[model samples]
Target: MFRVLIAVGLLAWTGLSRTATGADATDAQGEVDSARRDALLSQAQDCELRNDYADAERLLRKAAKFPADERVSAEILVRRGDCFMKRGKEHRAYELYKKAIEQYSLYIPFEGVVERLRAVAERFASGEASWFGVKERDMAIEIYELIIAKASSAKQAPADTLRLAQLQTEGDQKLEAVQTYRDLMKRYPKAPEVPEARLDLARLLLDLAKGGDGDGALARQAQHELDLYLQAFPDHSRRAEAETWEAVANERQANALYRLGEFYLRPSHSSVGAARRYLHDVVREYPSAMSADLAKITLARLDQKGIQEPEEAGQPQAAPVAAGVGHAAVVPPPIRPPDKDLTPEKAAPPRPAKTLQAADQVEKWLLPLEDLSEDTGEKAK
Candidate 1:
């Protein structure tokens, strides 16, 4: 009786187990359908990579029929957003991106959705249409703010910031662009774009300096950033160009100082001494440059204007500084060499002194003879 009861219990358990297995099989079939949808979503992503939007749309539409698959649906939405963006459908792309993000929020983390949305915004910002597309600028700024808000978990926040900064530059908001670049460098110190941003900021600052800002503040900032770029990207291909610009900046600063000196020394009667000092500074500081040459010329002119430097007390009073005003000592005309063939004939040999004496003596003797003859004629008469 005990063995038969055990057997009966085992049989009942087996039958129940079979029924549960059947249920599991049915559930697994549903899962298989979901898997197929997910696989198709993956294929759609591949099509996007291949730039085959038609096939990608077809696959995504099929994946949408599997309403039970949330992950697949989110992926399809993202891909559809990409397709719309590529096709120049900004409003639709923006809408699709928002939808995708919303769908991803259901299960996928917000961080993942943020990156995709940021990318979508970048596509708009980078395209030529951005110049006229008000929505793109707004969305880009929004994305940047979003990244900043979630910076702690944002993997590509720096990249987003850089794109935003570049867009600002394109929009001609140089000050905002400079600040953004600075912020990016500070926030993402090791980002690859940091060097590029530094270079750009330096250029902008140099331009500011050229615009006549006082205190040399802009130039100082530019020099600092230039140093950063050189230190960071020493072997960059554009290194030569950067160096050239640095040299140009230094020259411009020197020129500005020299011009200030000239302004002071103008007819309005500012201190000539101060003007000379400024030029002297340029010559002393930038000896090998064109600015130094200009400074030297200015210094010479200043000296000629009776500008004097104190000398040792005992030293014989140095010649008074020339008051050049307008006149430069006329340089004498160059002497021409006597043409060998055209030179006057060698002077006739100086008559010998003895010969000259003999001629004088002959004249004396002839005069006496003539007088004697005149006396003789008188006696004969």
Candidate 2:
């Protein structure tokens, strides 16, 4: 019994000693981790204050190397990436953000790592730039392209395509932008972006029309796109803009048609039939639109010969008039000019207007006008 008691005591003492040693080891590790973390944080803060992003990044990398908790390690990687970005090392920053995403993916409880990744992605989307002159425009395009390619093989977000289209438009890559928008309509017909895309597309088309693309073609295109936009997003935030653009496009098309009709009576009538077709379209299809109202006024002017036809065939008729004669004949309409209320000084914007407004937009375009038939008795009403 004495021997058995001695053995039991020895075993208990050994067990207790082992437990103490284990606790000491754990406490030592905790202290080391805490010290390392504190040192890294201090170094980073110092580097940032001194504007030494390189040193800050180096310290962050060392902190990431420590076999600390996974959370701490991931956080260090993110901090390192942020420092890299601050230093204009976008490629390096992207790599670190990618690393953080991967590491967090392994232990994080979120549905996917996209939210964390998106934190960085949003900077690109919001148009941030790196010190290296790498703008978010480039990154956003790359990400959008990647998402589009991926969606083909997986459940890609429709929002990705929309973002790409928006970036392209903002970057002045119009044809590609429109194509991508069309792709969104085809691929994710039900996506929320589809309606917004349509609205944006319509506005772009109207701009094209006013910029002097074929008025007939542009008017048709704008009307079609605007109809689609209105159908899809009648109450969208930009609905008023869409409506206004739609009206402007139609008005332009009508003016083109009326001008063409007047040209038909000219001795040098070139494209008279085309002008009539345009006028007919304005009167028939856009009956309730401002263009139609202008069309009615034009038809009456032509009928009254307030715009007399150019003498035909040199047969004892009046001498040929100048090209602007027709335009001069018609009384200026009552439409309010955009800046009519402002004085010259007040009308001047901080910068010269690089873009055209609804009223003055047609000045730059060169679309063909239709010839008028000298006898259509329509009124402005």
Expressed as tens digits, the lDDT of each residue in 191-266 for candidate 2 is 7778787877777666656667642575677778888887877688888888887778767666665665555545
* Per-residue error (Å), model 1, residue 300: 0.4
Best by lDDT: 1
- For candidate 2, the 10 contiguous residues with the lowest summed lDDT are 324-333
The TM-scores, one per candidate, come to: 0.56, 0.52
Off by over 4 Å in 2: 1-56, 59-91, 98-127, 130-136, 147-156, 233-238, 270-280, 288-290, 306-381
lDDT of 1: 0.70
Question: Tens-digit lDDT track for model 1 on 21-98?
Answer: 999998998899889887987898899889988788778888888766566567667667667667766566667667
